[model samples]
Target: MILAPYYFNEKTNLSEQPYRNQKRRLEGRSIRDLPLYSQELLDRIRLPAERDLNDDPCWLRTYYDPSSEDSWGQIQDYIDTKIGGPVTVYNDSSLYNFGSNWEKIFLRAPQLLDNTCLFEEYEEYVEEALEEGIESESGDAQHAGENGYDPVEDENPWICFYSEYLFRLAAGHIYIVDEKTLASEGPDAGTVLVMWYDECGRAIRYYREEAMHAAEIANLAPCYLKDYACWDNAEIGESYEWGAPLGPPYGENRREASE
Candidate 1:
């Protein structure tokens, strides 16, 4: 269940737009990837803060270092001390003293427990990173690259995560589905269905479903995933006919098969 004992879960190079023809026109050129996004934009996405600090609002932070799980807990502590403990506030004045007043109420939102921050935990961890306009502490949540993520960490095994590096984690598993197999079987709980075509003109399933849970991937086996939603994707049903009603005789139901 313990995988990469010493990897961090923080990757920040995913929020960039690829150039139109940089690779072909400019062989030896590079440019800044992440353009500035306004803090106001982030505020629109943050959760509203508590009653006293309603002006600032709260934002959840994620860890992306991909090397340390302890950092998440430590950051939580750091945030608490910076804003206010769950029930206490050290600085009455406001982050405005630091010119980021909007973040004062958000420094450590008092109501994080109201909803889950990310898909993994059912609790929210508040912070002020959103006002800074930089990706939050947990990790970048926007884009994914093919070969840059790993989900297991022996050192930080408590914090289970997914990787989009060389392999992707579907819901949490190494999603591997071929066309023939996709046609044969439908989707699973966390798995997603993808559509790719072969010479025969049949819509094939190329990817497997994501892992059932983060805990499902606590092992050493490698798994890669492409982000997708089942019952979705253009090619699955539109371009290709992957939606034929399967014949009867379904596999033994894992359920009680209600009356």
Candidate 2:
């Protein structure tokens, strides 16, 4: 599964703060009393013709089936055209940490253990570790301790490691968009052109195809990939915004400077 950030339409009432503020109950102040809450603001906010308000931007999750011959072909073509040739696995010795149980599992039964099983096993291990408070000599455990594990937090390195492991198993290597490349190339580069293969080359390139916009706003490029069980159920060719060049306010300054 590929997850991409939602691109919001700026020329919409939903995108305005006043419209969003209407949903909230202002404790002491009237909604109209707020700054920028005026008829002028409402008049200025224009909805796109024939566009549904419900069609607001949202993070998109697209699933592809590697099992299907047709789907697999498309996936391969995309990797080849967009991501370039896969890096030699031997070049990056750190790709598969021999110490990881996930790596061990992959070596043992790469076909048998799906994503769900890996997640369950990871959760189980975390639970066992937390319950027992066993400070092991293993690198992962030591790293987890140093990072400070919190059950509620998604930022846990342990969880991130497993997530990447699952992605790597499917793709064989991951490519991350380089920061310098983004700054230099801007949004026109897209995620494809700016990405570099991760030093740990176990799998395919995983990136946010529309991350240039993200970089413009947040100054960060986020990337993630997941393997799903219900790949057959998802609609093919429904993953919109893949490989599309980023829109305005992203590379505008850089382009202007160059021009």
Candidate 3:
């Protein structure tokens, strides 16, 4: 019942235009929390690869217009149609993989993915992008987050996103890192990382703890956590072993396991 994922809202899509904005979606939003989904609920989704994602409004654009909110709502409706109830989703990446310019590439579909992907790249790109530096058309990424820029549209409107992050199973305890916004009123808001695990139990890693975008989730259970955290100490050198560092690009890893 690990509930980690990159849920998207339809309105989160880039403005329907030729030019791309700087606000790449899903830039940074990873955290650590206990298993919210019940065993029965987890069982409902039999697919080892199927982790659920929902509307993840970015911290910058906290307030969504009615239209945008409604678009996000539609994604929820679709989820309800399938699972029936406020279903919980286990995300594929680590706590660090949340933030990035790549989100814009993955928006508007069942899942998020690597920014640069081809046939089976999404399946592999998510993990691969983390290892190297991207030559962003818009070089100012720090501004990209603050300036509201998004990844340029992909070749296929239907084929957005690199791919859903793959999952590796680990076991341990859970940690939580919840963010609090001070807004402009208080001191500049900063993030807080919390570790949730049995005092007696051994500690673990939060999935996707490498992206540098997400903060740390100390003491979380490694069991069920994704082993290929976006920004873990593990380094991706000059060469690649398999396809992509993270997942199957396009043609691979598409089908959701039967629930």
Candidate 4:
């Protein structure tokens, strides 16, 4: 969903962590207390009811600021702390460059998908590529073919070709979340959270699977759908589960069941 841009009323003050403070302020408050932009985003996401919040792993939310230099590091730290090791970051398709590169990387190293790797390998590859003046452009692969260099023949095609994108993933430049992996692996394997942010980088939200997970990261409780103004309008039949339809079931299966 296309979310409206959100801007902070106050000026940017890096002296203190403004985003951290904002996250703290949002805790324990009704969704009604949230700014209109935040409320609108939450409404579009359609959170579950308060009664199901604890039982439903999909209803949790967290907070983080991508604009902050330290925020990515903290996210990595959180994932590491949860999993006891570094995670193989997966980017949303919305992250065009990272997503495309990830597809290529997966083709070359399918075993690495959703698996941890030594951070040193990513770092070393990046340093060597930079020293060699290897262009990260998409056209570079085509150019290499003309020069008699075939990347497919390489033992480590991911390292030989898309190492730059791998570096970005390891460095946390791209946002990463995979729901299925999180579900199968459990929180100890690492929890993934969806993030939303305004174009101006003034506001950010982390949609998590547990309130404690969110609170631990933001150091504050998260706002819930119960606090939203539209919560009262939610239909009794609405499942509020992630990826579930908003209304009564009406697919072919429903017809067959009724018959």
Q: Which candidate is the best by lDDT?
A: 4
- Candidate 3: segments with Cα more than 4 A from true spot: 1-67, 84-86, 89-259
Best by TM-score: 4
**Candidate 2 — which residues are off by over 4 angstroms?**
1-142, 145-154, 161-164, 171-190, 193-205, 208-259
Residue 58: error of model 3 in Å?
A: 17
The estimated TM-scores of all candidates read: 0.16, 0.17, 0.17, 0.21
Looking at model 1, report the run of 10 residues with the lowest lDDT sum: 1-10
The lowest-lDDT stretch of 10 consecutive residues in candidate 2 is 232-241
The TM-score of predicted model 4 comes to 0.21
- Ranking 1 against 2 by lDDT, winner: 2
Worst 10 residues of 3 by lDDT: 1-10
Residue-wise lDDT of candidate 3 within 69-182, one digit each (tens)? Answer: 443343334333533223333222332223322222122221322111123333233334322222221243453333233446322211112111221111112212112221
At residue 22, give the lDDT of candidate 4. 52
Better of 3 and 4 by lDDT: 4
- What does the lDDT come to for candidate 4? 0.31
Q: lDDT (CA) for every model shown?
A: 0.24, 0.27, 0.25, 0.31
Worst 10 residues of 4 by lDDT: 1-10
Q: Write model 4 residue lDDT over 38-121, tens digit each, in one string.
A: 888876544223111221112111222243224434445555565432233432232213321222322222222221222435
- State the local distance difference test value for candidate 2: 0.27
Report clash pairs, candidate 2. 171-204, 172-202, 172-203, 173-202, 173-203, 173-204
